[model samples]
Target: MSFLDGKSLEPRDEAYRTHEITKKGLPLSAIWKGDANSISQLTVFRHFDSASVSEGFIGEGPNTVWVIDYPTLERIYYDLVVNFDVFGSVSHQILTRMYMDYLRMESEALFLSFLPVADREPILKHWYRGALAQAKVFYGHSHLLIDTPAAIHYGGKDPKNELIRMIGTRSMRSTHSARPTTNYVPSDLKVLDNLSAKKSLWLRYLPELSYVVVHDDHGEITNVISMVVNRAHANVSFIFGEEDRRIPEEDTLMLVNGLLGSYPNFIFWIDQSEIGKFADAAKQVSDTKSMDQWVARYGVRRTDPRIWSVLDRLHYYKQHYYKQKDGESEGLLDVSRYENL
Candidate 1:
């Protein structure tokens, strides 16, 4: 509750102090209607508690969630906040970036704990597509991780996505959140998801995050969604040649309900009537010229007569409607990166 906006906690006893704290002061439901069902299944863990669930940590990948612990948590705080210097020399910057790679791998390893033992290495290998000998070996040899088998069992061939599904069902069973965690609502997102699976360049032209305002056939606003493009990386190990590490054909996409991310690279307005065509057009995007034409069709450009009006309505819906319904804060979204397209 301390983490969620409009949610809070107070000691029952006014005189209570940190030294006097002995157990959890609130139940899991007080925090989440049902939180961490997958984690609570871990009966082998001796020190697991509701406090750990309250931490509310998550990993980088689609299905990867987390419960951060003290040492690594401290290291994370120090690694980026204390040890890093924005004004440092090029070598210093390179070293900082290099250190972050191993930290990311550790976080990824925590996600690996939930997968079936046999599937773990294979999935990780895909994540590290072009990783060199040392980078590949580093994950298996890490002292920071333990081989904790998942308490949950799987029955399907696709356990990775199955686990992801279970997590969503359990966590969202009681919340009033009007959002989709993964996959996507419209068929468009599924198209992007499927194309990525087949190693298509479907997501290559999209920015890191794009805001989409969907309207009904009657021209009434229906929903606002964000398209998140996750560019596939062969390896983050090497300090240079970022272009070489990129896997454009395998780039993937995620669509989340409501506003997401700090910088929205593009803002798009689409009537529900043309939404299907939009996805089809995205799948067929072959080059920059094609993308420009597509943008001209759906995008709200800087020169659009109603540009500010469109932005205002997006903000109005986010602050007045979504914020009240979801209990999630709706802060100002950044548009400094808005695409001229």
Candidate 2:
């Protein structure tokens, strides 16, 4: 606490200020008001349709759940943000990053502590593919971790995946005391979950971010999902020449419910039945010409007449349904940054 006593954050808006409670920022409002003692007291619920998601979301499972326990949280704030200088020298930046790395390693180790001890090393190995052997030792054995055995009974040979399924099962709650925080994915959209790395080789060609819409028999938008392509790396040990570490074969596709990004590389629309056929068509592409044809069939190209209409429909869905499903509405997606053929 003494370390952060001199530091203070400048308030740019009414959201972070001690103001009258509004419809937005209900979670932070609870803490500012007398309703909640801490942020932990406020219920936070999230739904992830895919295991392959952001490191912040999945860490390396369906989601990353780190046990910060107040002290670590305070340290993370002071060490990562308050202490980091944007206008400082290169050495200052590198030092801050090194401190953050050590913190991340410890936090990740803490997350792994929640899983069965036998499963810990293997998951650690997968998460840190090309790290030096000594770094692995510190992350695994040397770190101060939660020593108690995991309370949950894990199933299957793959406990990491099984844990994700368990969390998903628990979140299918019909009722919760706290207000729901985000878009409730349509149960029918579960079809996309079946597409895996083993079967869906076409996933390699997909862009980093994609907005996909599936239509019903009447040509009405039945479901909206985001396909996030996660590229695997050999290591996080360098800030320079990072591209050399790319291992495309190890990449994974994440099917996220609703619109996930502001600027999607492309938007693909297809009927429910055509999804399999679409995958097959994409999988057969041997060159750019074939790839272009596949895009012509399934994608809403920038030059297409239907592009604006598709964007409008997506925006409409976000406001009409998501505003209530989640506590807040996101800003409009700007098409100027979107990729085209």
Candidate 3:
């Protein structure tokens, strides 16, 4: 007889013998109730711990009256207990974006990459799925939540400011919206020599991106853009490398100065501690604009109404090292701390 067919037989009947509940000499009445007939025919197995129970089949409880197949139930239960956060995050991304679009509002986009060792492949894949889910959420809201692989025009058509083509993927070819505009090689002589005259080194290995993202690793990605930027020899370089990579603080000053002419109206964010260095660099480049004056006229500080109407609202403020007021000493705060005007 089929096991399920046998299950239909009455548990109290002679054909289906019931096992007595016992613990030493005591009856398991608390769980089974006082009447012997009330005891369930289903075996009462004890799990070693919550983990074992958690790994059990998914779907509604025994009494809920549902019909989920075994394989599906098992998959659901395993995901619920072992990777709940990832599943929930992905679901939330989709649902929340839908809600935002229903309200006809744009949602802010965020991109995140998770890095984990090789041994934790399952967990890492879940993170990648979670990121895709987040992207979908933003897309649902009628907002574009694009991944880094997205290619489009970042600069105008003017030859002086056209989009730089990092010499890597032709993926942008598929994305007709952002065609190859400019070579955009950096002006710095040193970076050019280092990169072997490659104007667009970032495109060299699009295949690697697939695996990196699939594996949910970001170490390679973190360096790609910076590597591309360095090749162009731009005055202001955003270099990335292994953890031991040195950020060239001194040369950064030169690049910031060069940006003054190229991107004068642009606002920026830097660590509060680094603000002084950037300011000093600006001074060395041009004495006409002091930090306070620049903050008052062109920076985000200007638009702030609480303290001094010092900053604009477009650029979001973030934390940085800082000096304390009242001769307190050096510390850190967001630009808002100074702008709370």
Candidate 4:
């Protein structure tokens, strides 16, 4: 028996509307509507988990078939890679290679497959925090002291951004003291002592120099330390620097656990390295053959419905609420829309 023989893959109720809206911009939908025909053949297959398949099936069975030209299918693949932020550049390349390999193995056009969305916020957050912590551990020899004016001007009200900007700013006027040696000492080893010292310094000089950025050298800037003062409480949140290198999963997990034990409140951002590491680890742990296989097998199951809902709302915003430019519009999508996703 086929894997999808008894299963209904059709969308239900609101999901049907969501499906239709998402398909509007898809290449497969365009091909089905006869908008373009540049391919020799296109084939759609339903992905199924082998574990869920009945014993009689050869492997996981495919269902919900669609046939189009090869050129059309290739166009769809390119469209997905270009339009979707769902996969990073490396991941996109991997997917493209996987598609080609699968096509070669099966001797048919590989067209459409279902992918579930996953909630990556927590994992991303953890990874980001770990990067910051790791930066401090690996590169904490140089320190950059930023004056209050630069911190205020660049960061505005956000303490985190203010701290990051203070370190990131290229202007020399904002930099009170560049690469202060004494401050480069590892503070994590003496966090309590450093906190007390920081508090005292804040009490005396909080109004003058409110932020600081610490680094090892001026080369690649793999790590940087930032600090913001809380004037009212006469306290400081010592923000560790971020690293660009891909930290191992075990290292990140250990670092996070260690940091949590040391500092109750630690701030970090999920850098590309951590994100890539997490994705690789997830692929390894998954029962599927590859990252592409995992996506095919569980993409829809991991997909967050809120993405579709937000897209629908954004469409509404663009149509009814957004201001028009000469009866036309510019790109309606913003980076903020994918912040939580």
- RMSD (Cα, Å) for all candidates, in order, is 10.9, 10.0, 26.5, 27.8
lDDT of 4 at 143: 15
Q: Lowest lDDT 10-mer window, candidate 3? A: 207-216
Between candidates 1 and 3, which one is better according to TM-score? 1
Candidate 2: segments with Cα more than 4 A from true spot? 1-65, 79-93, 140-156, 163-199, 215-222, 271-280, 283-287, 334-337
Per-residue accuracy of model 3 over 1-341 as CA lDDT, tens digit each: 32123222233122112334221111112121112122111211111111111111221112111112233245445444543555466656454334333222111111111111221233223323324454344334321122112222233332111211211122233333222222232233123212221332222211110100000132111100111111111111112332233222211111211111111222333333333443344333223334445444323333544222212111111111112111222222123212211
C-alpha lDDT of all candidate models, in order: 0.58, 0.57, 0.23, 0.26
Look at candidate 4 and tell me the lDDT of residue 125.
33
| TM-scores vs. true structure, each candidate | 0.66, 0.66, 0.19, 0.14
Residue-level lDDT tens digits of model 2 in 166-217: 4433333323324322334445544444354556566666777777788888
> In model 3, what is the error at residue 265, expressed in angstroms?
15
Residue 260 of model 1 has an lDDT of: 59
Best by lDDT: 1
lDDT over C-alpha atoms for residue 182 of model 4: 25
- In lDDT terms, how accurate is model 3? 0.23
lDDT of 1 by residue, 64-175 (tens): 3332334446767887789888888998877666666655665565556556677777777766667746545555454222334444568999876776556555666644
